[model samples]
Target: MSEKKFQTVQLTLEQSVESRTKLIQGAINRAAHTAGVVSLAGKGVYVIDGLLMKSGVTLDVQAGVTLMGSGNEDKYHHRPGPFELLRNQTPICALIFGNQCDNCVISGKGTISGNYRCFIKANQEQAAHIESHHYPRPEMIYLQDSRNVTVEGLTIIDSPFWTIHLAGCQQVKLANLTINNEVRMPNTDGIDLDRCQYVVVQGCKISTGDDGICLKCTEETKRFGDCTDIEVTDCQIHSQSAAFKVGSSSFGNFLSVKVVRLLIVNSNRGLAFQLRDGGLARNFQFSDVKISTRDFSEEWWGNAEPIYITFVARDHETVIKPDDGIENVQFSNINANSPTGALIYSDVAGRIKNIRFVQTQLWITTEVGKMRHYDLRPSEKRQSLIMPVSGLVGRVKQNQQAGLSVMYRSNEDQPD
Candidate 1:
């Protein structure tokens, strides 16, 4: 795989990074530096090491570069410059600004702060001695296998791991980005677009601990199809989890997701499309969402339920056989104000068609319970929750011109 050669380099904030470090180490030693810019006016640590850290490398940082991280220079946080407080150090562990670089573009208006501990704490056993704490590794601004990339207007702050991680890329575009952590920080995932493809996340503003804006493609990396045509528009996803999510890692196949004009508020679980264990989601949509009610106590695993869609089969590494559930989903014109009345939950045995609540209006301050749809009854044996069949339960048996407005209710109350 060798036939890609194009480079550009530019570094501002008044040059002279110690007399241009051997002319920036000879235009990154023959790869010929296609594009590089780091406007220094700073507290230092612009130590981009190795064959200038291979893979094409096209970095652009103009408007005031303050790339310093290693934390703790007394307090008030943020410190550790001089290439991470050196003393015969070479800890430049794969800091390749842009890897597999195609049409790379890491825009100006800079800031890539790090110092370890956005959050990570492991070493369990809460029965006796064993215990540990550190948290905050959400400092991963990695854009892997890059393609037509564009990480615009950056202001990435105190990421101890996930500010922006676009793994296995293709035609990526994360616009007007601004990711931050410190809401009880632990594995702070602000913007994680893993196993990427034609992505477009616009006008971002994320608050994190987990799941601010996540669209993952996983099934243990066999690379199963469909992370298709994504579009997350006009964003502001403040999260604790599910400001927006699809698949807990759907053996791949998290298809055609579209979230338009969102302004998610105080999220614990606002607008979610989660596939319980397996994945085969299709043409998903969530439009015009706005939710608030940070905490009115009740969050037993949190159920503010603005609109939750779940499909559980479990096992991406083997054990999922109910035909790895979830298929063709739709949620339009969303509006929320829930106090919890089971807004939505699809347990999954298949066929979750056109799930709409058009021109939606929900302000159920408590008690609107039961809207479960689990399906699976063809002598395939047990798995039914009923109450969903606007159409396509046995291929259009009812909706019969909306007669009796369509009826079928039975979870075990029977009597019909």
Candidate 2:
């Protein structure tokens, strides 16, 4: 694996859309000061108001290059002077800006158009004169605190937010991405791995409004600690939310993860392991999954569950911090057809441990109706134990024996 010798620089197309953003930022600062290979060939529309690549540069976007996004939110929120307080709360502003770079690369098969409805009408007219979190729409690739990053074969479309944001990265590699946003686009997340480490998202074809692939540790990323050894393989996810998620900004700690062979279609929720605020979603492994969830609009957070594990206490009057919950999980060979049937909650000071589901095949259908129980919540402090299956199968209604009907509730509220 040794074929590295680039010094190619070929960019020149200024037919004046304001001089094509200063001739593509001076041909990417003359191919990032000669570490070269900044080729953006033919069929031009190249108008970038932002681009800051540097370390061992290689922004080779060829195959009839499009790279357009000069949807002027004050020229992509201008503020890179004194590093602007080290990217002060990155509200929008990013059309390919990799910082703290190592062996960087943004490969091709061109098209990076994040002209998302003119930046969502310029963030709704700058949110009626500022302060709706200072609305400034712009992100079509913002890799931060980088290490050996590589974004392969791109076809990234209309993203007004989180299209590919890898923060505090380390040895990352995102392959075959074809993110197509605007399914009612709001927070357009297709790939967002924050506080990253040893990452790899393979053969991706994400469809999103939000959270098609997300793993975060926020409070604006707590100094890049634990979002350890990740791996997502052969994905084809669709989401309004949760086609694959980790938290609701879980502070940090999601070690040794693995999601294999996924195909989640028409999603509202499928495999969301959320431990709000303080996070420790331990040793997860979800294999060969195929989920098809429905039901949307409670303003979208997901109820058409194919699996939604939660360990709450984001605020039962605050103070539930250190490593909240969700442990040693495993779900093997699942094939779910949802009408809302899988949820496991834990919030009496968190404890949802050693959960396992093997050779599973669930089909809970009322043809999109009947959702009885199984949306576990703080229904009087939770604790779980639903393990007894030799290849569990369920498809309720009519002579019912596809199995799985257990209900136990006893804290003296008797019904064991």
Q: What is the lDDT, from 0 to 100, of the residue 400 in candidate 2? A: 19
What does each candidate score in C-alpha RMSD? 18.8, 18.7
TM-score of each: 0.32, 0.34
Q: Which stretches of candidate 1 lie over 4 Å from their true place?
A: 1-97, 100-142, 145-165, 169-189, 196-205, 208-213, 218-241, 247-265, 268-271, 274-307, 311-322, 326-338, 341-344, 347-416
Q: Please name the candidate that would achieve the greatest TM-score relative to the true structure.
A: 2
lDDT agreement of model 1 with the native: 0.52
The local lDDT score (0 to 100) that residue 74 gets in candidate 1 is: 24
Tens-digit lDDT track for model 1 on 40-65?
23434453221132344444454556
Model 2 TM-score, 2 decimals: 0.34
- Candidate 2 per-residue lDDT over residues 86-105, each given as its tens digit: 33554546877777877878
Q: Tell me the whole-model lDDT of each prediction, alpha carbons only.
A: 0.52, 0.70
Q: What local lDDT does model 2 show for residue 97?
A: 77
